[model samples]
Target: MEYLKVEEGDQREPVSPTGQFLNSEALSLCILGVLELGVPISIDESHMDSLVKDVFLPTNPRFSSIMVEDENGEKLWKRVKVKIKDHIKTPTFPSGLSPKIYDKYIDDYISDIATEKLPVTRPLWQIHLINYPTSNSNAASSMIFKIHHSIGDGFSLIGVLLSCLQRADDPSLPLTFPSVPLSSTNKDSNGLFKKVSRIFSVVTNTVSDFYTSIVWSSLLEDDMSPIRSGVAGVEFRPFSVATVTFSLDHIKQIKSNIGAKTVRVQAKQIQLHWCCSTRGNFAVMFPIKEMIKLDSKTPWGNYFAFLHVPLPKLTDDDSTSYSNPLEFVWKTREIINAKKSSLGVYLTGRLLQVLKILRGPEAAARYIHGTIKNVSMGITNLMGPVEPMTLADHPVTGLYFMSVGAPHSLVTTIMSYNGQLRIAIGAEKGLIDAQKLKSCIEDAFQTILKAACDDDT
Candidate 1:
């Protein structure tokens, strides 16, 4: 954690409380993106280098720095001279890598990058660009960077990516997003539950579920499957990336067939504690662990929570009773529906406060780290732009990313781009085969797509 040789004009800023919390475990968030450039287009490696050096480096000077502990043992950031060659790497693929071979190279590249920790001697990020033919495009290439988790969370990182970009067509025009409100208004607007009714519901429903969750976590673990390593499993394992692509229209069809909105909303309002991991989401019928705190006031840096949701055993015969492809989803809906009214998430938020009060902040942070160690696999679903995006005049066709480490070996990331929803799976190499997991997910999704829409759904 000591500083490397001091550099000129280097300024040190104390790592935020959240950053300190993550630094305790030396975890980093690595973002891997696959950019699709359609047809054949000439790309100068020097131009790409200059673009990052002049545009990207100036836009975020912090990217030209490293994280180190100062004399007082405080986590601090110090600026360093930007090294274009060290930061932007150009990897070449064979002349005839056939789409499949190229894909394998990509998988290997991601897996290798996912296991790499950012060096404290250089900037916290690095981009690896490969001039190769992608299954989606010929001029396409991939850029994978290792970012310290302390640097920022997904939301902030996405913001940074958008900030550097303007409307592809007109560089002068700023990129704008349609203002669509994500969350709903206050419950009072519904004119539904009065104060007295709310009190009664909280006392009866919320209190009861909180007590039940306590009993559950204290007693047993959420099913022990291939993906879940259980309490005794190896906690510190390396990670890898796996990917699967599904039809966006087909997913919507499944949603229509089964009032999926009603299912998710009902689950959220009722006994639900629905949360997501770098991989995916599910009910956390366990103890509270590491969750991001309310510290998003900063312009950019990681201020996020960690929710580890286990993957269900897709090959289990017991889960195949229903004929619909969405049987897994419907079955999951039923399981979560029962606990929709629970106050688990609310109680979880209070856990750190209670611990900080009784045991101290350091103790509370340790408790957070300890609780997340038992988690084995993670799942994430990301929604992206319906239309393609261009970077430096080249259209970006496909994009993807993955979280490097979280004490858990397996992490799953899903992003829907254009007409397809691409699911990227990250797991420890020896612990689980990324290819097998991808196959399982694809098979399950296809099974649902091939089934008929039942009237009951």
Candidate 2:
């Protein structure tokens, strides 16, 4: 790792290994997070200018910088003068349009921008404002933020956004995240034999999983199904984004009845069937949780890695598993627990670092592209503030995000905000019906909720 020297009034920082991989030419990914406002509002370009210059830019220097190669040929962030107007987009829609018409137009606009690559000459981020009443939000306006993955992971970017937002109810009070407990209980009291057995299981599972990841990236690929296109450069294709909302109360009931540990357990259980049902391997992106918990002084960059948690397929012969919601939860829990016990996820991160040093960033990036493309889909979850927050004084009604340019037919992003869970599904246009997928997911949630209620009764 090398850092460029900082002179008086000059700012430059070396790009981390993980950042290099994400921003590489072969695999450039962007995070598209949308903020739905409670009231219709117009964008005051000058006020937004102040917000960006005074508040947002101060949160992270990378927000006002561009990625460039230093004299040593190592990529680094170079601070540059930012024209706030260049980064802010105000999209105009036809006037006197019905709510339904406006909704469709908004969706089309999002899909059109989702597949675009941020310009490297300037900062790799932009904010698009749609100030119109829509049936979907029942609100007057929404804001879509497009930030390059190279700048930071989803969590880091969320933190920066939080700094710019204040509690809608009380601006003086700080926002808080929901407390999710660990699913696994203490097992240190187990007997020596039991401990040894666990160790053996960990080693066995880790080796098997790491090997499977290699094959998935190299020789094997997910089979084409209703949810997967199995086509190269699928990320560049147009994608339709649809969301399904779930009540936190219902999620808690299911967790209590099923003895599940976290909200993700419920989410993954529902997503498992809808995303894929093929014999080929599927992988989900689990962040390196420990790396993401940074102090205030920590610089922002890509700080998380993907865990290739192998997804199981549902075949016609496995009718029992599909029919019994309780049994499905239990099976999903078992798989998640096993993956947690293994070290394959951490080791995979190390392998990428080694590849970066031994080969180069391009080699590592292509490897990442292959690993991501071979999988049927990817899923990510981020917890939002418990209380309502305001962005530039506008009341935020809801929040959700979708990843673009990932080379996968399906990408699911889950966000929990204000006692509700929003699961945004990004599927390739024409290849996968986004609404049908949402229906299946919603049905799955209801089935699980009913089963949990029955079990309680």
Candidate 3:
């Protein structure tokens, strides 16, 4: 358990024992799963060497290092080495292997690797290049990207990876590796103490600053509280899960049309429509409609809520058409907006009940362990191309990434980068046909794209 020096003026202060519980979905997913893809393209050893040396080396910190204190209490960054694993096998699908088999491989790999202990010896990333047999008895290649979460968010990690490529034939260009500082050893006990002291001081200051700011701002802020009103007072029912995707352009257009600033609006529309159509219960909703109202009455923590969105039963005279879909989507957006305007409080008194049970050590352990059984799907959309990325000197054709959540029912991740919109869905073993889900999601995205494009026509 060595510590690293913090660089001056860095926002993150050094902490003892370094690692913290993942607080964001993007970070958690990067740490929890590997990116496995089959590449129809191949390169020589020198090219692979260049990719690893230039691309992998410089971007190592996004997943490898922890912030720690030095004896003097200055901030610094530590770099972790990414791990590489090799498995030689035969390929089967035209894309190099069948999606079903590839997904199974991913499941097994994640089960084997997910853990809390941060690797101390190498960079916190791994690469596996599989050169295996094809169904045609010819060799095919695949690449696996395994990175830890603490280093950077999903977007940043992907950016680092893409930085490794040049144009397909322009490998001769000098590599532009992201600059990183060298790793330094903790040398003495005083260094550790100083780091701890600095961390304590920083935490104290932060709490004080937050308290003062909030107190002063309270005098001038308006009471735009969250409203709890919706098509409530209706019975809730279980609904079947379905997914849809929209082209990046259409998503942008919708955002522009709605004049929304954040993805919360989009997510709310989805929740509203699903509730209206199926009258089903939702486990959770973000930008909780209740948070605004209850901020002063409750603890200032994330206070989301779950409710049932009841749908009207379909009549024989009702027809499913493009008009119907548009109407449903529009109505859902309206309901969400109406709820947003009226303040409503979410009941969080249950949390006290949970805390009471968790007061005991045994009970706390039991509760934490129980999370393994209570998995729920989470949807996170990383909208649009922030930047371009390449790999192995080849322009990226397409990119997709996903993370597996606990209880493992299904977790959907959507990201649009470089003119491509990608979706990755994780499911429990034997619970979902990954191929079918993939197709459904693709179809959904296509449907949305067509609708948007048709509007243009």
Candidate 4:
């Protein structure tokens, strides 16, 4: 196919391999990435209109282009003239509804949109404004950004969102993140014996993990539990979204009390253990383990792979043993460290590339879908700026995001902003109890925090 450019010589390139895997007409496997931001004041449509036309469309050419196929049926991004009004939505509510009713309306509104597919005629994105008082703090308005996963993952999309935001206190200054020190282990060894042993261990573990991935994708699947609906076409099914916020300072205290190396480990430890106890024994699946691999010279696109991280198993006695909850933290740390030492994630990426070359993208998409379909649940996390941010001159009161159209019973997305972590749980609407899941996660956090405090003394 010829690389053609029109009068406007911009954004006429073939879609990346991963992008095709996500958004091909033959196998339309798209992840509708939705981000919800709460604002302290009511939304101004005029300000948002200007932002969409000036700031957003100009930030990335992908935001202004539509995916089209050539004679050979290969997807290419073609620039198009965007109509700002076509992409903006404003839903009205009753005049005198209470805050509680408005909250329910907001949740129902999000689920309604989550199940709908984005049209291919225009740019694959939209913005929704809900100018109603929500029960979450002083959030009188909520802004929803719906973008296709083909444009970018949560990480790069967050960057695009950041481009539209500035420090609420000083728009002249740049946004920053908390100085959380990265944890690393000493690799110094006195003899060749330890080095050789480490290499052998990594090789053995990689082989085992690769084999497990193959089996799980084909023959074996998670058992039918409360969270696993085991239904066909679960991706198209509606899912409920719920959010729970935790103080970063309290998480740090839990880490300090238990002598944990990093706050991330402590936070995930609570979640992994909670899933094992409250829901069922299921491996926590990541549809795209390595979400973004940025090349300094190339523009951002879909660059994601998959991984299956199993939750630590518990026996009947172990399930009842809650006196020492710190063991959960220790076990999770060990499992993560072992995963870091292996090459399973890289191998999975290579395998997908080979499949794309030999069998074609539809097969590759099916393989990817099967990997996600067999799993009971999925989880992903992202980091936000440390300081307060504003969008179109309105202060953001809260921020959280969730991935829709995933073929699973449950998917949890976490993001940290300012000084708190927001955990958004997306679960199958009729099959899973989202509120009960939220309560169980909260219980896990409190259990760990209490145990840490008692042990510190």
Candidate number achieving the greatest TM-score relative to the actual structure:
2
lDDT of 1 by residue, 1-457 (tens): 3345444456977666656555454333355555555534355778877778766676555687677765555567787787777776666667876876887777677666656666778887877767676664344565555556566666555445545554555667544432223445576655545656655655676666555444433443444445555534233455556566666666667666666654222222111122222232233322122112212242565544433233334444544463344555665665455444455456754665576568654555565554454444544433455555677776776666665555455565665566667666666667677777767666655555555255554
* lDDT value, residue 92 of candidate 3: 36
Reference-based lDDT, residue 328, model 4: 69
Model 1, global lDDT: 0.55
Clashes of each: 21, 0, 30, 0
lDDT of 2 by residue, 331-356 (tens): 77788888778888777778888888
Report the C-alpha lDDT of model 3 over 128-226, residue by residue, as the tens digit.
Answer: 554432221122334555565445444444445544444343455433322223335466736878888756665654454334222322322111111
lDDT (Cα atoms) of all candidates against the true structure: 0.55, 0.79, 0.39, 0.73
Quote each prediction's TM-score: 0.75, 0.93, 0.49, 0.90
- After superposition, the stretches of candidate 1 with alpha carbons farther than 4 Å from their true spots are 1-10, 39-42, 92-94, 136-139, 166-224, 229-240, 262-299, 308-327, 334-369, 450-452
Which residue pairs come into collision in candidate 4?
none
Q: In model 4, which runs have C-alpha deviations exceeding 4 angstroms?
A: 1-11, 25-46, 180-187, 275-299, 319-322
- Which has the better lDDT: candidate 2, or candidate 3? 2
Give the Cα error of residue 321 in candidate 1, in Å. 6.5
Candidate 4 colliding pairs, count: 0
Global lDDT for candidate 3?
0.39
